[model samples]
Target: MSWQLYEKARGLLSEEFGGIKKSFGGKITIALCYPNTYQIGMSNLGFQKIYYLLNQHDDVLCERVFLPFPKDEFSFKKKNIPLFSLESQTPVHNFDILCLSVTFEADYINILKILNLSHIPLKCKDRSEKHPFVLMGGICATFNPEPLSDFIDIFFIGEGDEAIDEFVDAVRCFSLAINKGKDGFYKRLSTIDGIYIPSAYDVTYKDSGAIEMVLPKNGFPQKIKRRWVKDLNKTPTSSKIITSNTVFGDMFLIEVERGCGKHCRFCLAGYSYRPVRNYSAEVILKEVSEGLRHRKKIGLIGSAICDSPYIDEICDGIAKMGGTISVSSLRLDRLSKKLVDLLSVSGHRTATIAPEAGSERLRRVINKETSDDEILDAVQFMTSAGLTDFKLYFLIGLPTETDDDIDAIINLTKRIKHSILKIAKSKGHLGNITLSVNPFIPKPFTPYQWERMEDTKSLNSKIKMIKSGLKGVSNINIIHELPKWSFVQALLSRGDRRVGELLYKCCELNGDWFKTFRETNINPDFYIYRERDFNEVLPWDHIDSGIRKNYLIKEARKSKEEKTTLPCPEVGECRRCGDLGCVMNI
Candidate 1:
């Protein structure tokens, strides 16, 4: 081990406010790995929450590890030192279990880099009893685990609130009986719900390179259903460590709600995290009161923040504690005056809203359920509440998008900026507006899962058209994501085990995807541009998100017909969307 690297990590740990450290002796040691830089990984509330949850077990001791820094990577390679944990500077291979929290598809290549730098085998089949078992979870794991299935040993199928406890129990039971070999160990884990053991299943491919069938052996469940916490008040899902190293370092974060009731056809979270659940006002007030002791700013995190029944009270309570409040992008329809008033008094200067598409026709196809006039009204309300900085998020290359729709985006943005100026000038102030445009990437388990992604050439042309239309607009900043990177995201989100070969080629080329494609025989376009039929077997069919296939197909047909589906009922009525059972549990 490198003493210099160990001291650097220890120095950072000492500066944190609530970092946990424990002895690994006579305990089931687990390395909680994040495949990103320390600064970025430490900022994630999910990573911090899982670290806190795992350490609560008396028999388990969890430590943190991240991808080595650029200079540290070279130094470790020169010294032949394996990646070590932050708590005690112990090698990762020395731990009994190695669990990963993967949130983004673009980080798939970084996972490969972490394994190679740690001197661990990249493929799960090559690992043995001497190596620590590799487990994966998070949003990326929940929807589709096939792209990296060849590497992950086990995948936690859903939310980590309850799944973490279930996993720790399995670890404890398996460790006590050392005589139980690998087969016995797998069988014991299979008995637990929400755990997917990929090695125990075999996937067959058809002649046309599509999935034929997935067979289970040794009584493994044919379809792995996702697990989630029924009650949000039962657990604490907040940031445990406070340090000024991450992007959100100055703020303490808490999840006010989970799942989205607004079922947008193009959104994966809307379909995957079904049956919206929210933390009660009392629970949120308790967390905010406790969090104020460490930080002055509190970020309310949720996919549907405005949907919470107690959002106004939560925001008001935080203000009483003398803490500034930050929130995720809010829904346009739910942007009430009372909510905006709470935000203005809580020292919020910037507001964000996502109008997903510009034209009403395009919006109906994706089920955004918001009109251009409604978006303008929301902005007027926000500015009236004293917000000086505004952000508008939109997406390009959507299904059924036309050149006129692209022009509508420019016209819509200009109208929004004009409204902001009209409101600002009345208040003796000027405001700035930022436009964030991104390319569309079809994800698995959503209504648009089988939709074909627009090629880079077409996306680039559309992007240029938007830029040209907004050329002379002042106080409006246009920021768009590159088309090339979106292509990479689409491939990873819509690929199978066959994509594993491309990952290896990328590692050898040192993160160069274009060159890797040229050198290898794999055609990236096959995965990105190919549209599938509803009857064909999808890559993620083996893992069920509790949403039935028939419902999604029906929704896709409705999308083509330009019909809109209603949002989830606020009163928690049974809608029979196949997640009705989970809704009943709430």
Candidate 2:
């Protein structure tokens, strides 16, 4: 409640963040935080969106904060200076709430660092009414919040547009009633939409290694429907876009659609965000008009931008307005001429295609039914439409992946390059193609959860062999992720509540992963590299996200048996996914 930190954070805002100072209006201090370093956090569109959203609230002023970089962390520790918000150089503790936007499993530890910097306790039980209430949102919260539940005060599930608005309203009301309000705000806040107070529930694990029951102990609803905007077109993306310091700097971001119907077996987004939705053509044009004022380039954001019925119209509108556009990779099976022509005319030279796998056989395992011929056809379209450069994305080490199946990577890329070359010779155009090889990490609730990740050595060898085979394909190039990051991601994604210790240790050691491992008593490999039994109880069993465990088990069984499952049509009740209790419900 002290203004000391707020003054420091406000100083930072005035000195470094020009846009933030302009939006501050000399009152109402709030810190919109991305729980990672400036370099990495600034890259996320969600983080930027929240920064833009909060600042636009007239009565409320928004500032910025990110996880301190390693060097900055050392400097702060040496000087004993607390972490401050970007806008006012105000201390993180001074804000009414320290709102964190967490997008990935790995960033869980970073929240601990930000909290420690704010002089707040790492664990929730260690804090009191004197501290800033910590609230978190984003994809991980939507899927699973139990592992980190003991620390965060509030977990927001699903889309934040509607959920956060409700949260802000509740906070404002609480601010007005603080002097005479009843006790246990956590219990009261849990009653709000999309809000799950982790402290209000009780869980009983059965002896059979399953969650026996999750009873709502307080006055909170048992089920929290995910907040979704009925009319996404009017939901922001306005002129005051925050692009100056972000990864996609000076680029306008426009949403073409939200949700998807592809319903891939191993994809959580395919299941969790049910019933596809999109912006109308008119709304899209309006968004773009506002976006282009800040930047000349547009990055269309969505699960399947191509699937938006009005994608062509939107792309054309941007082009006609003298803006360039970058698109998400497509199914290739659905790449259309109007889309290609619109992009080509805008001087867009590179197009991306996500085949997911080299062979159609592996594609079927993931429910990506696009054929090799279809992919080749898309390459031909890109080439013929005067867009020569292309990037191909593929996954390796999926369940049922064999050496023969992997050869398709080389085969497909070379064949694609040959087609592009043949067309280029006739059409007098030259082009280069790139193939980004990524390893497939099986995730929980996905059909492949039952499958084991391919041994790291084997996957790397396969990558090397594939690259070796491309000796003569000059037009083709290859790039891939370091295997270690994937290994860490696997370790974190499925880890139990026990991992909180490791994450806290990680941030405490200045983001040193190795030292964090040494300090922890638990073996991370046990949760990461080890396989789980079908009857084992997971750490995230307490939160209810609306999906069912039975369905996930069935899907896992189907994947194990090499059988394909069809997506339920968007007709009636959306069947629950196997993981029942999740913050997605929260």
Candidate 3:
């Protein structure tokens, strides 16, 4: 091991507040890895919560491993240093299990990089009894595990809060069996509620390269059901470790809720994370009180935080404790005067809102219910509360997008700029409005899953149109993601196990995806550019997200007709999506 690398880890550990270090004797060793840099991984609350939960087991000693920075990665490659955990500096391959928390498709390549650095076999078929079992979880894996199926031994389907404990128990029960071989242990884990053993299933494809069927082994279930925590109150997710080296370093993070009730047709989180659940104000305030003891700022985490019924009460309670607050983004339709005032008082100069589409017609197509008037009113409210700068998010190249829709975006942004300047001029101060534009990538399990992503050339042209239309406008700045990268994301998001082969080849070429495509027989465009028929089987058909496929089809039809589905009722027995009353119970 390199002394420089060991000392670097020790320095990071020294600065952290609540990291756990325990004896490895008689414990199940897990190297919880995040396939990114330390700065990015440490900022993720989900990764931290999993670390906290795994170590909560008296028999499980969990440590963190992250993708090394460029210079450190070079040191590992040149000096042949094995990847080690942050807490103990032990080689990751020495652990019994390597649990990867993957959140984005772009990080798929980084997973291979981490595995390579750790000296672990990149493919599950290549490993033996001596190799650590590879497990993956988080939103990306939960939605579609096929692309990584060849590399990962097991995939945990849903929220890790309760399911992880069950997984650990299974591991402990099958400890002796694991020494024999992974086959029997894999079969045993296949019986768990949320566990999916990829090797235990066989995927067949048609001549046209579409999935014919996904069949499980005789003992395994035909479909793997996603497990979720029934009660957010019981499982209070908060920052277990505090460090000064993260993005939200100055704040204590807490999860106030999970899942979104608004069924935006294009959103993966909305479809996959069904049945919205919120922590009661009492629970949030108690967590806040504890958080205030450590940091003056509290970061509230959730998909629909402002939609919580007790949002006002929670904000007021935090303010009463002399703690400031921050959130990822705000819901335009749900903004309130009290919330805006609290944010302004907390010294928030910038706020973000996602209008998604510019035209009201396109908004209906995506089921983003906020109208143009509501968007302007939200801007007015925030500016009146003393928040100076604003970030507006929009998507280009959506399904059925037209030139008029692109023009609408430019026109809408101009109106927002006008509104901001009207407020700033009177206050004798100027504020900027930034447009964060991105290409629309089709994701699995959503209504748009079967739709084709617009070509990169077309997407880039639309982006240019927006930039050109708003050229020379004062105090208005624009930024966008490269359409080419979004195309790659679309390919990975909707790809099958065959895509795994392409991924391996890409890694061998040092992430030259273009060269990987040119050298391989697999066609990347087939995955992203072709629209699928409703009768065809999808890559993720075997993974049951509880919302029926038929329900998704129905929603797709509604989108075609420019119709909007109502939000899931807070108190009702409606089973529109066939979730079996998960909404009412929550």
**Candidate with maximal lDDT:** 3
Give one digit per residue, the lDDT tens place, for model 1 in 342-423. Answer: 7788777789988889899999999998988888888888998898678888899999999999999999999998888888
Q: Which is better, 1 or 2, measured by TM-score?
A: 1
lDDT of 2 by residue, 383-484 (tens): 888878889888888878889888988898888888888887776666798889987776765555555666678889989988898987787889998666
What's the C-alpha lDDT at position 465 in model 1? 93
Model 1 worst lDDT run, 10 consecutive residues: 577-586
Measured on C-alpha atoms, candidate 3 has an lDDT of 0.89
Give lDDT tens digits, candidate 3, residues 135-174: 9999888899999999999999988775876788789987
Candidates ranked by lDDT, best first? 3, 1, 2
- Global lDDT for candidate 1? 0.86
Worst 10 residues of 2 by lDDT: 577-586
Return the number of clashes found in candidate 1. Answer: 0
Candidate 2 C-alpha error for residue 479, in Å: 2.2
Which candidate tops TM-score? 3
Cα-based lDDT for every prediction:
0.86, 0.71, 0.89
